[model samples]
Target: MKKPMRLSTVAFFMILAGVAALGVAWWTQHKLGIMPCELCLWERWPWRVLIVLGVMVPVLPARVGRGVLWLCAPVLLVAEGLAICHVGVEWKWWPSPFPACHAAHVVGRTLAERWASMPLMPSKPCDAPTYLIPGLPVSMAVMGGVFACVVFVTLCVGMVRSKKIRRF
Candidate 1:
């Protein structure tokens, strides 16, 4: 017979998944030199929060730990919503909510003044989507949306199963 999954195991998996996703973002930014847009940076925040919750879940009481895990589902859904919004911005279906999506315009009159006012490294425009896989039509934002949905579904299922297990 297969052993049932424990809350701690699920939390650990969440932590590992969050770390792995962040690690890929770090690698792409540092190694591949792909600077993230403002929306892209916003997407990372949910994973960071989830990772923190995952760490705390193990130390809390069983019922409380499961409640914390249950809380992750909504956070993942919100992340998914953000990813969808970003994908829409990338596709030109909607404008980005952030001003960083627009190109920087220097107000200085002189060329020297304008050049001095410009930022050292140009921030990536939110409208431009980064594709990690070569020759693939999918953007990183789409991938993030799909991953968020998967994680959200997993959390939902785990929560249901955990409740059923508790009943008996």
Candidate 2:
């Protein structure tokens, strides 16, 4: 007979996945000197939440832990939605919803005045796709979206398939 998937095992892997995703995002920004755009920064929140919530899932009773993990699907969906919005913006299909993503126009006749009008913090245009690898066609946002979809579907399938397990 085939073995059933364990909620605790999935939950443990989930915690690791969240950590790895967040770590890569942070490492790229701090170590690689790649500044995250506003939407990019916003994308990290769901992963952070996942890490926080997934930490206790392994210790909880099976049903309760599965319930908690099930709740994570909606969170992942939210992340997927954000990634889609970003992808649309990057593709010029629609403008970014965040006002900060728009570039500030330097409205001054003098060079010094225009210089003074520049934003204190540098910001990237949300429409530009950020590719991690050189010459790679896929964007980071698209990759994240794909990852979210895979995880969301996996969790849903796992939960539905293993319906009778009682312990964590």
Q: Give the winner by TM-score.
A: 1
lDDT of 2 by residue, 1-168 (tens): 357877876776677768877998988889988888899999999988888768878788887987898888888998899999999999999999998899987879999999999999889888888888898899989998998888788778777766674677
User: Best by lDDT, which number?
Assistant: 1
Clashing pairs in 1: none
Off by over 4 Å in 2: 105-117, 165-168
Using alpha carbons, what is the TM-score of model 1? Answer: 0.92
lDDT of 1 by residue, 1-168 (tens): 345778887898788868877888899899999999999999999899899989999899998998899888888988899999999999999999998778987868899999988877789999899999999989999999998888888877666656534454
All candidates' TM-scores?
0.92, 0.87
